[model samples]
Target: MRATFMFRAGDVRVQNTPDPVLRYPTDAIVRVVRACICGSDLHPYHSLPETPGGTTMGHEFIGVVEEVGADVATVKKGDFVIAPFAVSDGTCEYCREGLHTSCEHGGFWNDTELGTGGGQAEAVRVPLADGTLVKVPGAVDESLYSGLLSLSDVYGTGWHAAVRAGVTAGDSVAVIGDGAVGLLAVLSAKQLGAEQIVLMGRHRVRTDLGREFGATEVVAERGEEGIARVRELTGGRGVRRVLEAVGHLPAYEQAVGIVRPGGVISRVGVPQYRDAEIGWPFFGKNTTLTGGPAPVRAYIEQLMPAVLDGTVQPGRVFDREIGLDDVPDGYRAMDERTALKVMVKP
Candidate 1:
């Protein structure tokens, strides 16, 4: 089998690797059918130091179950399944509370130390099989693969951001960043009945898709200028909910500036900085700061129906596709801002 690995910054390669096998009673081997590179993957691609064997890449994927351990009951051989980015014991207390990302015995994909392989490959060793994989009901059309794949990460993540921000009917919300997650946040906000959705991004192509997703306005500026534009759009009062989809410091600062008094700011983007502002500015406004890794496993079932029925098209974020061998090129396209999101067929 072949899988993607990052030898160092700007060096991603699809290399030959041994096939994965079930190592635990709760594990399953999934032959990846669809996978993609995530924006978060770019973090390591930008600054990871050289490694002897390189590190595995990718997290989001939907595949056909080729094998399952004796203890696995929810899914069996030949079942098409969705694997969340994180591995969790479904029976844990946190999972019962819809916070699978915080499960007592949970971890992420590509944890080589834990013997887990990357999704951008021919197959992956999915630990906590019954708890981590969701079977797609019945036969699925090939056209829906990308949409179903989005639920594994980006779509669920966007839903998490909106849910954490407490988006409600007739409320106004501002979403920062125009990445896949940010655009999906716009879609989620619309579904939650947000009356106004402001998408802040610099790219015209992505922002246009954001508009189609539900952004009532687009603010392409940054810093103070962007903050003022959002304020002006909301009648100089800022929005009640600010969904920060970009993990950078500037994006967070903009969220602080655009959140109205007594509002909430949900950050779903993986944080890239160490420290952030949490002083008088947020304190004086009584703003609530929330959001994290987005326990996407919890939302998969809730969001899958819409994708299956074609009610929503969150997969529109995927602007390009490549074969398993072209993963290196996929990473470069995403890193260079030439692709909104890249889908992989292994």
Candidate 2:
């Protein structure tokens, strides 16, 4: 098998790896059909410490089941499935409550301890196959592959931000960042019935797509100016919900600035900072802070219908495509802001 590995910052390579096999009763072997380089992958691409053995890269993928262990039942050979970024046992307490990310037996892909290799490969060993892989019913055209792939992470992640923020019909909302997740957050807000969706991003191409995704307003400014502009748009009261899609501290600060009193700020972006202010600004306004790793496995079923029916096209976020061997160049393109998202077909 050929898989992606990162040896250090700015280093991604495709190398031959041992073929995956069912290692546990709950495991499954999947032949990768499609995978993607997530925006979150860039964090490691920027500054991961050197690891001689290299860290496996990627988490989002959709593939076909080639083999399943003795205990696996929910899916079988030849079933097309989507693997969420996190692996979990579907029978766990947290998983039963739709919090699969907190499942007792769950872990993320590429975690060395779990040994579930990265999704950016020709095949992967899927831990907790019954829980982690959502079987796509019947045949699906390749046209919808990107949309189904989005369910594995970005779309689900953006949906989590809006859901945690409590977006509802007629509510006003603001989204921070213009990345794939941010644009999808706009889509999620719209689907949840938000009346005013303000997208804060500087990229013309992204914000334009955000508008198409239902952002009623686009605020390209940053810092105080950006905050003031969002506030002004909302009649100086700010928005009722602010979805902070960029994990940077500045994006957090912007969320604090544009949220109305008693509103919520949901952060889905992986935080890059160690600490942030939660004192007067949040406390005084009675603001609520929420959002964490999205249990996308819990959301795949709910979101898949729309994608299958063509009601929503979240896959538009994938503006570029690359083969398995070009993943290194894909990283560079994403890092250089040359591509919105890169779809990998192995």
lDDT of each: 0.94, 0.95
How far in Å is the alpha carbon of 29 misplaced in model 1? 0.5
Q: What is the C-alpha lDDT profile of model 1 across 16-110, one tens digit per residue?
A: 99899989988999999999999999999998999879999999999999999999999999999999989988889999999999989888897
Where is model 1 more than 4 Å wrong at Cα?
A: none
Per-residue lDDT over 41-151 for candidate 2, one digit per residue giving the tens place of the 0 to 100 score: 999999899989899999999999999999999999999999999999988899999999998988999877688899999999999899899999989799999999999
Best by lDDT: 2
lDDT of 2 at 38: 90
Model 2 spans with C-alpha error above 4 angstroms: none
* Model 1 global lDDT (CA atoms, 0 to 1): 0.94
Steric clash pairs (candidate 1) = none
